[model samples]
Target chain A: MLEVFGRRPYLVLLVMALLLAPVPFLQLNDYIVHVLTLFLIFAVFATGWNITLGLLGLKTLGHHAFFAIGAYASALVSHYFGVSPWITMWLGALIAAVAGIIIGFPILRIRSMPHVAIVTLAFAEIVRLVFANLKDITRGELGFWGIPPFNPIGIGDTAIRFGLGNAAGSFALAAVLFVGVHLILLLLLRGRCGLTFLAIRDAEAAAESLGVRLAAWKLFAFGISAAVVGLSGAVYAHYLMILTPTSVAGPEMLISLLAMIIVGGVGRFFGPIYGALLLTATSELLRDFGDYRMLLYGALIIVFVFIAPAGIAGLKPRLGRKPAEATKPVEAV
Target chain B: MSSTQFIELVLNGLITGSIYALVGSGIALVYGTTRVLNFAHGELMMLAGYGVLLFSVTLGWPVLLAALATILLVMLLGAIIQRVTIAPLMKREDWAFNVVAVTIGLSIFLQSAAQLIWGEQFQGVPYFFSGVAVIGDVRMPWQRIAILLVALAVMGLCALVLFRTRLGRIIRATAQDAEAALAVGIPSGLVHTAVFSISAALAGTGAILLSPLVTVSPWMGASYLLKGFAVVILGGLGSFGGAVAAGFLLGLIESFSVSFVSSEWSNVVAFVFLIAVIWVRPEGLFAGRGA
Candidate 1:
């Protein structure tokens, strides 16, 4: 399985994407389709976070900041400025990438994992507090509602609508963006960019010795990851047509991302995707459990770490592959 | 603006700073000794809050006795957590990120479990000390003053132990070089667990002191946890002394800033200060100091 994935990763992703593409149109409950869409959104988010965290060995616990930045930027711009969600979404990603780079400048200088984690977490808190306090603009936890959805697209005689009334179009849109993001990640990681990240993660000093600009490469990864997270956030905002600072920028968002990557198998290319799918389903199933939902998720994270530190991806037997690589913990500097 | 107000603010800042010191130093101590940033350190404080509530409020134990019992219980919990969750991970060659992740998981689990057991309603504890002390134009509650004095005493005691005790020597040696410590027949793993317990005791103390002022709730630890982390970074990661000083510095910063800015923006100001500090001194302000 590892060999096949290693050799033809795109083929596997394409097959998976193809298999899931029909779900929205399968006439299933709209709620189920909505949940699947959420899974894709989170998968995008987890994958984005993995670039900085898993690949580059940056122990960031604040990727949700980017998500919130994207969501709020897109929502605010589209809702207040009359801009289309389509345009604002990309703009939000750009904004988030810039924020990422700016934050990265200070953060990348710190070598300690705990320091990085604290700094990033503090930054996210700052962001959350700012959004929460900006009552005039964000409405201050009453939640920003009535945000416009993605404008309907017309093709020939048919019109593809968005909003809750039409889940298929939204799911289709999410799927397209999901595949596109993955393809971009695949291309980037399969090339020199991935090698540089690998070098940085595996041996920072060695990579730095070899003339790899550590800060620049890290900023690059951080920026791209932030952009992808922002994009997902933008889509989520438009899909849900509501926004709350806590819902997007809170530590809960960060924990969810962490759970996904950890459960999926950190450092593996498709780990977050599998983790997101499993957790999303689990989350929906545990919805009836109400307050116990997060408790269970938390317990699941610990149990998985204890029982399967390699995550779901690591559960499979990878013949001839380096077991050490699968189990290797993120190096703390 | 007025001298009296300024004095009151300073007193308040110091009182708040004392708690910050407790929380921050706990985090710094754990990180310094174990190199595992315990993300769930706040949960220890949270558990202590619930513990005090259980023993003092529900069971009708005396406040001091309940507080003492809570701290001990939390210390025991810290040891258990370190042994069960962290020790195994640390045995692995690359356990840094895994330990951090596991603590995060543990934090969430503890928080949610607390909510499940206690419900979401905020439960207030009656202040053990009553009455106010009038000094010049400033009036301070005896309870608040007690928080300051007790916190100072607790931290001072911790300092004494860390600097003067045999266990302290063993822990510091392990922190400096685990292999060297092990070669000297020091049980580094046991030291790690001990350090965790000590850290939890500090956080538990903070929780007991804070419960009367702030209502006990499941998510009570979250904000203070962030502030505590900020204090750690500001002080320098793993430097207990630096954490103490930084904690006070942060508390004062927040207290003073709240006067000029809105209360909500004080957090932003405090965190911005942290980021600026990180930018200038990534190794922390006291990076070279030994554990």
Candidate 2:
């Protein structure tokens, strides 16, 4: 069974797609739909983050800075200039990408992992502080509210509307973004640049010896990852219709993204997807635990690090026949 | 600002820097010996603060005794954390990333557990010394002076140990090269445990001193953790004396920034300074041996 599934993984993806295709139309309650929408948005974010963190092997604890920048850029642009989110979102992404390159350039020069983590974390704090202090722009702690939602497009008199005021439209938008980001990442990882990334990650000195421009590729990964995360943040801002420093760029967001990728299996193509679904579902289920929710997350990280460092994606082979053989192809994929 | 006010801020910055130096040194110690950042260092400091609250506030123990007990307890906890979580992962190919994740997990665990145990209320202890010292129109709180004195004394003691004692030599050896230390029969595992304990004890001391200055809460450690990281990086990772010097430098910068600029911008200035340092001089201003 494992062999068959492993050999025909695209079949599994197709089946999963078919299963999820009707979620918005299922007439699920608003709460469930909203939660699903959030899950999808975060899925896009975690997947994008995985490109730099998991694949490129950069340990950043401040990817939320990009996300926050994107949200703020899109919201402010729309609020002041009355630009459509359809246009402003890309602008936000471009801003975030530029910020990423600027931040990643110098820090990536240092080879130390902990140094990278500290610099990135400090960069995020600086961004958050700037946002909070710029009350005229971001409204400080008052928060930027009433962010205009994604407007509907029209064909002559008749209109095709997202109607994101409701959960269904929001869910549809999130799903499209998730699928789009996921495919881009998947294709990127399957190509030659992906091999370059793998080479840099596994052996930087060796990759550099082979004439691979280490600085350029690392910056590219960081920029692309930030752009993708920025896109998700734009969607998130529109859906929520409000943006706060803590809500958008807080340490909790970074932790959640890290937990998703770690729990799913870092470096696996579908790791963030499995991680997002399982973690989001579990957190939702354990909502009654209230204060204990974070405690559970903490425990999950510890347990996964110790018992299943490879995460859920790493568990399939252990449960299958010819476990070692089964693991090889999955890892290669 | 007047010279008196400037002097006061500079003194205050030094006091703050002393605490930061103490905390950063602990983090540096652990990192030096184990090659682990100990993301939970601030959490350990938080735990120690709670320990003081538990003993001195709840049980009404003498402040000094409570502090001594808390420091000792925290040291043991740090050693155990290293032995249990970090030591086991040392052999893994992904030790660096795994250690980071485990420490992050441990940090969250310690924070939430503190909230659970302490009921999320802000806790505090009375000033260790209640008085003020006035020198040439510059008035300073006695507590602040005591903090600086105690931190310097402890750091002096740590320096003496590291330079003058056999265990310190072993630790230094291990930090320099674990395999070489092991080949020389230094028992690198014991050195790791000792380093972690010493680091935690330093954090506890800083926490006990700081508890009187700030409202103690479960989440208080998070900011300190960041500041400690900033100090560590500015000092250059694994450089103890550099961390101490950088701590003072960062403290002065923050103090002046907060006084001249808005309070919120102080953090931004500090972080921006950190990024600037990283970009310009990754080796740190006072690059110590093996930094």
Per-residue lDDT of candidate 1, residues B1-291 (tens digit): 999999988998899999999999999999888888888998999999999999999999998799899999999999999999999988766588888888899999999988888889999999999999999999999999998899999999998888899988888899899899999999988899999999999999999999999999999887799889888888878899999998888889989998999998999999999999899888777653667
Query: Interface RMSD (Å) of model 2?
Result: 2.3
lDDT minimum window of 10 residues, candidate 2 chain A: A1-10
Deviation (Å) of A189 in candidate 2: 2.0
| lDDT string, candidate 2, B1-291, tens digits | 799988988998999899889999889878867889888899989988888888888899998899999999999999999999999988888789898988898888878888887788887788878888989999888998999999999998998888788888888899999999899898999889999999999999999999988968998778799999888889889888888998889899989898778887989999999999899988767767641
lDDT, candidates in the order shown? 0.88, 0.84
- Residue range A1-333, candidate 2, lDDT tens digits: 232123444654667666667997899988888888888888888888877887788888889999999999999999899999899999989999999999997777698998999999999998888888899988987899978989976679965455355777778788888777766665666677878887888789999999999999999999999999899888888889898898888877777788888898887667778888988888898888767867877888889888888788766776775556664644311
Question: Stretches of candidate 1 above 4 Å error?
Answer: A1-5, A318-333
Q: What's the TM-score of each model vs. the native?
A: 0.96, 0.96
lDDT of 1 at A265: 81
DockQ of each: 0.66, 0.65
TM-score result, candidate 1: 0.96
